[model samples]
Target: MRKLFRRQGEQRKIRDKSDLIVKSNGQRNSELEKGINFYAEYLKHLDACSSGASQLSPSDEAHTQNSDLYDGKATFATTQSELLQKLEDAYQRESNLEEKLKEKIKSYQELKEENVSLNKQIESFTTGQTKLAEKHSRDKRALVEEIVELQRRLDGLTPSLALKEAQIARLETEKDTANNQVRNVTNQLQCLQMKLDEARRDEAVISKLDLERRDEMDSLRNSLKRFEIEIEDYKEKERTFAEDLSDLKRALREAELLGKKEKAIAEKALEENSGLIKENSELCAKISLLEIEIAQLNKDNEFRKMNDINLAELAEIRESEKRSKLEVSRLQEKLKAEQERLHNTEAQFDEYRKKEEEVGQWHHRTQKELEGLQTLSSSLSNENKLLRQDKLTLSDRCEELQNKLRKKDEEFERMRDEYETVSEHYRKVLEKLELETALQHERAGEYEDLVNRVHQLSASLSRDDSSSKSSRGKRQTASSENSSGKSTGEEKVQFIVLNLADLPVR
Candidate 1:
């Protein structure tokens, strides 16, 4: 029993030390220890006083215990004025606590009003973000429609290009035929040139034959004159030479006939040669015309080749246009993807902002709750302190009353035992109260740690938000630059297309 009492006393002393330390907040441990030691010494003094009083009159203790449970009231009358003064002080402390509570409630109401206004502002921002998102979606839809139309136009243009290619192929075939005709005409001109050379040689031979015929006729005429002279000489011989003269005349006649026949043959040959010359001149003129036609055909072929080059260039231009169109489409797709990512990012940002706002609101609420809980804990601590003081004074009065009963005799012995039992029960209650206060202190520490962690998390999230905003700004600038680049590419494609259009078709 003594050991239990000692343990209880030790526990009470420890509780008092912890309470004093808590009340001091940051005061020195030495002060707390001194306070605890002083309380322990006071408790020991009370115990000594009670022990001395208990031995005074143990015989009348039972009778005193049975007489009146309220008999100690008259004995406590001497301390009435002091008790009234303590009560008045307690009322003042209660009123002060009430005023502080009212002030906290008013501040809580003001915080609630401010939170509502901030929520309204947040709602307006969200609505604006939503509107901008809608506009972006509409723009995306329009771009998609425009792209589809361009694709349709490209599809239409493909068949025209094919038809143009077919026409070019036909033009190439025509050019080949014209080239063959030119080659055939050139071969004919070469053969005609050889024929013209042969004709010139024949004309030279005809002129040489005409000159030999003239010389032979001149020689025959001279021989005839000599025969006539001989005839004349023979006539003088009269009758003897008559037969010879007649023979000579007949020979002269025959020579005359041969000369006439030769003249006719020469005329006929001259006529035939003149006709051949006329025919050759006609062939030369035809050859000249054919040469001119061949030259024209060559010029036409050159033109065709140039047309082919132009067509090839046009086809190349078309290919480049197609490539540009594909690039544009690809860029559009990239833009679409970027827009989608931006949309997703915006959504995530909005969600993060919402979560941050919620966290801020939660932090505020937790702070308020913690403050209220702290105030309640402090009030409870103060009440516990006052209750302990009251209990100490009551215990001192009870010891004095007990001592008086002991002096009254051996009849109060049973009352003393009952009082001890009641005292044991009260000690147990006080120990339980101390344990409860200790649990509250531990809970308060946990709440403080939670608040600190919340603060740290909020700071980290704020940093992340700032970085995201900067990155988003960079992306916007990059997107603008890409748009400018695409516009330039489109301009180049348009210029190429226009140049291709201006090229002449074969």
Candidate 2:
């Protein structure tokens, strides 16, 4: 019954130990899951922080997602620190983008103002053209009025000139008639002089009158008196002729003076006509020049319009160029950020892989520990079963010895006392063996506990490998401890065996 109770107690302890192991494994699994979740959350936060960046390409996004998967396995502290750095970088990029946008807007506004100024210039040109047209019309009206005034003056002068010409012709005819009359009068006077000479000669020849011709001489004297009277009349006619000739000469001089006056007036009129012709030529030249100026103005207006169109096109081209440059700059910044992120992710992945390798090694070591413990427990259980069998056989031997001693009590007292002493010595040896076996079990337990502690220390050392010197020191310490543990276990085994061998032969 005691054996059964003891075995039942041992089984209960084993069950309790297994349950404790299971609980511990569950807690460890839960902690690992929590750590993994925390890392994933940190990676997600980083993704959110970088999401607003405009420069991300499809390839970059893909790389980010892949990096997230890798980073999910990273420790919490590393993910948090890296996320903060990324957030700062993203903010800086955003600020740069905003500044570029503002510059573009300013350029656009300046272009608009320039276009407005060009329109105002075109309007001014149109106003100038209108003013030129008004001036040209005023000049044309003034020229027409002057031309009409000159025509009226020329019409007024024409009749006066014709009347002067007719007066000159009539004066010439009258002068010619007076000259012919003077010539006729001079011929008459010459004939009269010749007659007088003949009369004087006849008077000399008939100085004394004959008696027979007395009656004829008295009649001839009477005829001579009549001829003298006729002579007087002829002298008076000659004097009147001279006076008429002088009058004719004075009239010719007056006519010549009038002709000179008319000639002078005609010359004045010709000069005036020449001046008017020059004025007309000048006006015509001005008209032609004004037409050419108008044509030039029209051409200039067209050129200005073309220039405005060209300016607008140039402005558009400049704006497009600016936009393209801004986009390029933004893309370059995004590419830089992506490259930096990729670099950080690669480094994180490398660290994560190293940690994973260390974890795997740790799990392998733990499995080895569990296996070793299982073997030690099984060996202990087998030793206990053998000890129980030995105890049962020794009890049976004790019962037989007591029965024989009771039968021999009348015949061998001395032999009975000697048997008692031997039994007591055997009991002492069995007690010593039991105590040694217990000590061996306790040593085995201590060895297992030391192994577990060493494994834990090694795991901690692997985790802190960032400090190369410290990890090296820890590794050296762990090696020394492991050697010491092996040596102690071996010594304990040898001690147990020696104790077993030194037992008495009784």
Candidate 3:
């Protein structure tokens, strides 16, 4: 009866342990399901973040386009508008992503709470398992004591229980089956422990992934902030460029006005030059007339000398000659003044050429600026074309100016050659006048010596007359010879004066 009670108690204990193991398995399965569901939620969040990141990649591409725009490569207002739209869309998407992230974060928090609860539950389960193991050990010790007591009873009552040996063998088989069930329950508990460890490892992996995702999100936010700042800088640069364009336009207008003024000034200068040319032609005519008059005066002077003109008349003629020389000198001074005026004009032309060169340089600079502006904005293409046309016109004007300058230089060279010829002519005239003056001085000395010789011959003739008749004949012959010599000398002097007067007036 005691053995039967012990067998029943052992069977009950096995059944209870199996029930506890089954309940632990059911709890473990429920916890595993919760963990799996949490993992699924985490995976879903990860997928959402990945999708958001994928969407952000396009935004980054758009940002690159924005960078290109900043580099002055966009279709102006249209591109700006499109970029604004894209930015707004990106903002919306980011907002949506932020909301999703917030939701995901909240869910992650919930999952963490659930994980904490699950961990607490797992710990309680482990404690329950430990308690159950301790209880099982105490029960096993009691069972061992009971078995010892039963063995002692069996030894004591072996002869009497000989007829119940088959029943005892059957009880032994039941105990062996209970032992197998207990071993299976222990193996199931160990499997549950392993499953719990695996769940913990999975949770650790999920937390690590969450941290990485948070880091990525932070980086994305930083990048977005940088993009916003860059966009602002682009806006400021655009404003500055617009201001520069306006300034360029104003400068171009000013240049046009200055060009008009320069044209007027050039026209005035041309008129003045024409007048000066007319004056120079008149002066050349006057100089030619003066040279003709000088030649005439020289011929008249020679004629008067041949007619035995008085010294006072000669003095008056010399005074007239001096007046002519003074006039020639005045003409030369006027020519010099004209040359100085030409030099001043040349200096002015040089200044004008420098100004034109400066204008061309300014034009080149403006063209460069315009080209840069054109690159910055496609909307300015038409303006650039117009500017190019203006440049073409300006270039044509520059070519015309250069041609005019060449002509002016040629004219200046001709004028200089003419002036040089006139100066050489004047120098030749002055040399002739100097030679004529030296000849006149030598003729005067010869005339004075002939007059003194005439006086001496007349006095000698008078003395011969007062002395003897025979001597008077010799004196007359001598006087005749001297008179003949004097006549020859006077003819020679007249010939020389005529030759001098007849010299070509170059």
Cα lDDT of model 1 by residue, 187-289, tens digit: 6556555554554565455455545544554554565455455444444443333444455456545655644565465455556546655654665565566
**Can you give the lDDT of residue 92 in candidate 2?**
62
Candidate 3 lDDT tens digits, 1-506: 35444545555654565466557555655755565575577557555655555556688857754664454433345545765665576566557655655665666566556556666777898899999999987976565455435434434443443333344345446545644654665565465556546545655654565565556556655655665565566657767888898899899889878877876776777677677767777777888888888888788889888998888988998898899889888987887787677677767767776887788789789989988976876544444455556556655655665565566556556655655665565565556556655654565454445445434433433333344243336566655644454344334434433433342222
Clashes of 2: 0
Q: By TM-score, how accurate is candidate 1?
A: 0.21
lDDT of each: 0.53, 0.52, 0.61
**Model 1 segments more than 4 A misplaced:** 1-309, 410-506
Considering TM-score, which of the candidate structures 1 and 2 is the better prediction for this target?
A: 1
Report the C-alpha displacement of residue 333, candidate 3, in angstroms: 1.5
Model 2, 1-506: lDDT tens per residue? 35444545555654565466556555655755675687677768776845733357878767765676566546445756765565465456546545654655565456556556656766787899899999977965565454334334434543553453354345335434543544544454344344434433433333222222444444444544554454455445545554654555565566556556655655665565566556546655654665575566447546767776466655665575566556556655655665565566556556555655665565566556556655655665565566556556655655665565454443344444544555565565556556655654564454445344434433333333233333346467654644354334334434433432342211
**TM-score per candidate, chains pooled:** 0.21, 0.19, 0.37
In model 1, the number of clashes is 16
Ranking by lDDT: 3, 1, 2
